[model samples]
Target: MLPPDLPPLPALTRAEAELIDCYLEVVDLLGRINPARTEHTYGGLRAAQALVGRAAALRDALAVMHRRGESEVHAPTLARALRVLDGERRAGRLALPPSPGG
Candidate 1:
């Protein structure tokens, strides 16, 4: 059996969409580079390197939005979009694991 279809993404301005995509990319790279979760230095190093570019893109996206006068963030709408995009799970990789037994 096939899985259910995902809900449609909320309507967003082009700049807002770009911002969300760039933000998620950076978050995913950071998650991969998280020291507590990474299994190998080389893998984390690669992620960190990629993070430099992703972070730049994220910055650029914000700059574009700001220059376009999108000064106010619609947090509720963006949060809904993030939830639709599995951002919570992707970001969870950044958290430290629970210490042994407590």
Candidate 2:
């Protein structure tokens, strides 16, 4: 189980933990049976991939914000905002506003 305060991974958010557990179960089963025999049939794998992207973005943002002196009081919320901002920047869909006193 994950810590209670932090936001859950999207795969663990929109779906029950049991669903992810089931996916992991299948993945484990395939790993044990014939690792090369199975392939992802649908978006569960895609969603898993996206979730990894999101978590990576969030982690990078948290590191950046921490370096920029965003205190812990604001870190968690700012982490989420910065993750979204970074996503938009990557997608060429948005620009970040100038920092104060910049």
Candidate 3:
């Protein structure tokens, strides 16, 4: 459960919500597949396999928004939603860890 002190999620249209959900799903999968972070290839392979569908879903979500004339992304609002959803930490997994000796 999210902490009570976290800000409320911004209101979003159905397509927008779907887009964000799909985007995060892809992010999570990529994080799992990060070679710098993963200890085994099998798990990363599974996540990599799953990433294809998630990427398609993310594409479809954007297409839906485009068809609905929501051409512009409201970055500030979406950033707030991402912050509330722990996107920073999730995305951080994509980065390589600091060098052990440096």
Q: What TM-score, computed on C-alpha atoms, does each candidate reach?
A: 0.95, 0.32, 0.93
| lDDT (tens digit, per residue) of candidate 3 on 10-66 | 999999899889989999999999989999999999999999999999999999999
- Which residue window of length 10 is worst by lDDT in model 2? 11-20
Clashes per candidate (backbone, < 3 Å): 0, 0, 0
lDDT of 3 at 44: 97
lDDT of each: 0.92, 0.41, 0.94
lDDT of 1 by residue, 1-102 (tens): 999999889999999999999999988988888988888999889988998998888899889999999999999999999999999998898899899989
Model 1: runs farther than 4 Å from truth? none
RMSD of each: 0.9, 18.3, 1.9
- Which consecutive 10 residues in model 1 have the weakest lDDT in total? 30-39
Return the candidate ranking by lDDT, descending: 3, 1, 2
Please identify which of the two predictions, 1 or 2, would achieve the higher lDDT against the true structure. Answer: 1
lDDT of 3 at 89: 94
Best by lDDT: 3
Clash pairs (backbone) in predicted model 2: none
